[model samples]
Target: MRVRPELRHLFAAAFGLLVGSAASACGTDAVGIDACREIESARCEATQACGATEAEAMHCIDLYRDQCLHGLQSGQEPGADATARCVEAVHAVAACARAGAATMADCPAEPLVAAADPAAITPCVVIARKPEQLADCAFVAKPADTGTTTPSGNDAGDAAME
Candidate 1:
């Protein structure tokens, strides 16, 4: 049976919308650029409470927006939920501890490439008192395996073969 051309187009459009909506529902979209600044500001305040000079705090916060924008563009930053969690973690810090430059244990780490390349560092790193304290952001362990390697199927099969 031939599908009407218009109906085919309509079906494609509907499928696209469904896929997009599903992704949105699953929170796959990264946090917006504004989140970068918000996290930076909160971190700066915490640091300032600890003893950071106003100038130092301001400079640190200033770097976050542009750097975060860069990270987001680079696709190396955390998603919206991760960023939000980081923000909350920062906010939860005791004023004195934050002032003392305590590690933010809950915040996501800067991506490895960003860590090695200053230009790619995420906004989160901008607020880090010690960037190293933050772990590397989770990334795929390695590029997709492109080599051809048939699975042995099961441990029993491998044992029998051996």
Candidate 2:
């Protein structure tokens, strides 16, 4: 059986296109922990301006790094480009807060998740400066209320943001 040269080329091209599309559909270039740290740092700085003490700020950063690392290991984080955009958005708000903006409403929200899979965007990129706001992000585990309390801003809510 002999196929024409043109038909062979067309089939090969179609196969190549199918393979390329499938590869693109699957996620690659996961957001690394380092980029997560940068994003957390930006959030911490912004929170500091919102009156979080230095110790609290450091704790927040640490907590976030741990969460980010866990997410990376668990394959739950977004792509590097998405996280980078998140970093930029968080930094912009941080800058605004540092410049004495009364509020940080301009900070970016968690990236929209595909409606088909609500949990697809697990390990959310936290941008909240306030404890209440941090509590609202999905996939973040909240600690049981311990009678012993930390500083105003560096409570369980702060820890959960990571």
Candidate 3:
């Protein structure tokens, strides 16, 4: 998703704060601090704009752990707010996955790209698919008869179906 220029600075600031917290928590080096900063920035931007609930936001944060922190330590530029952004992106994708499942009758199919590049998926898809279920839906991964699907949203439906 294209971040608005006006919000970009705000996201950056939020991210910087998150990263700073992470760095201080971990007590790492300058590179680690930089990586944390970047990750936080991306995460903040994605989360604010992701339109996901508090639970999804937390999930996204978990997803960003490796890409945002480890990649930086390994000397790889994981992109802007790589970790945090990735987490947010994954959460968005999860939201989409869940919405898609509702459309297909509780059997939300996982995105083909989920394993390859989950970050590419956006929450807009989820919002588009399950407009009514957003508040009630929760993120859940279902084992389909054909394969596995990770549905992002409230898991209330899954329980009802089972």
Best by lDDT: 2
Could you tell me which 10 consecutive residues in candidate 1 have the lowest summed lDDT? 153-162
Off by over 4 Å in 2: 1-32, 72-77, 99-126, 129-162
Q: What RMSD does model 2 have? A: 14.7
Each prediction's TM-score against the native? Answer: 0.37, 0.40, 0.24
**For model 1, what is the alpha-carbon lDDT of residue 99?**
38
Ranking by TM-score: 2, 1, 3
Estimate candidate 1's alpha-carbon lDDT, on a 0 to 1 scale: 0.44
Give lDDT: candidate 3, residue 67: 36
Could you give me the TM-score of model 1 versus the true structure? 0.37
How high is the lDDT of residue 7 in model 2?
Answer: 100
The C-alpha stretches of model 1 lying farther than 4 A from their native spots are 1-32, 72-79, 94-127, 130-162
Among these predictions, the greatest TM-score belongs to 2
Score each candidate by Cα lDDT.
Answer: 0.44, 0.46, 0.39
In model 1, which residue pairs have backbone atoms overlapping below 3 Å? 50-99
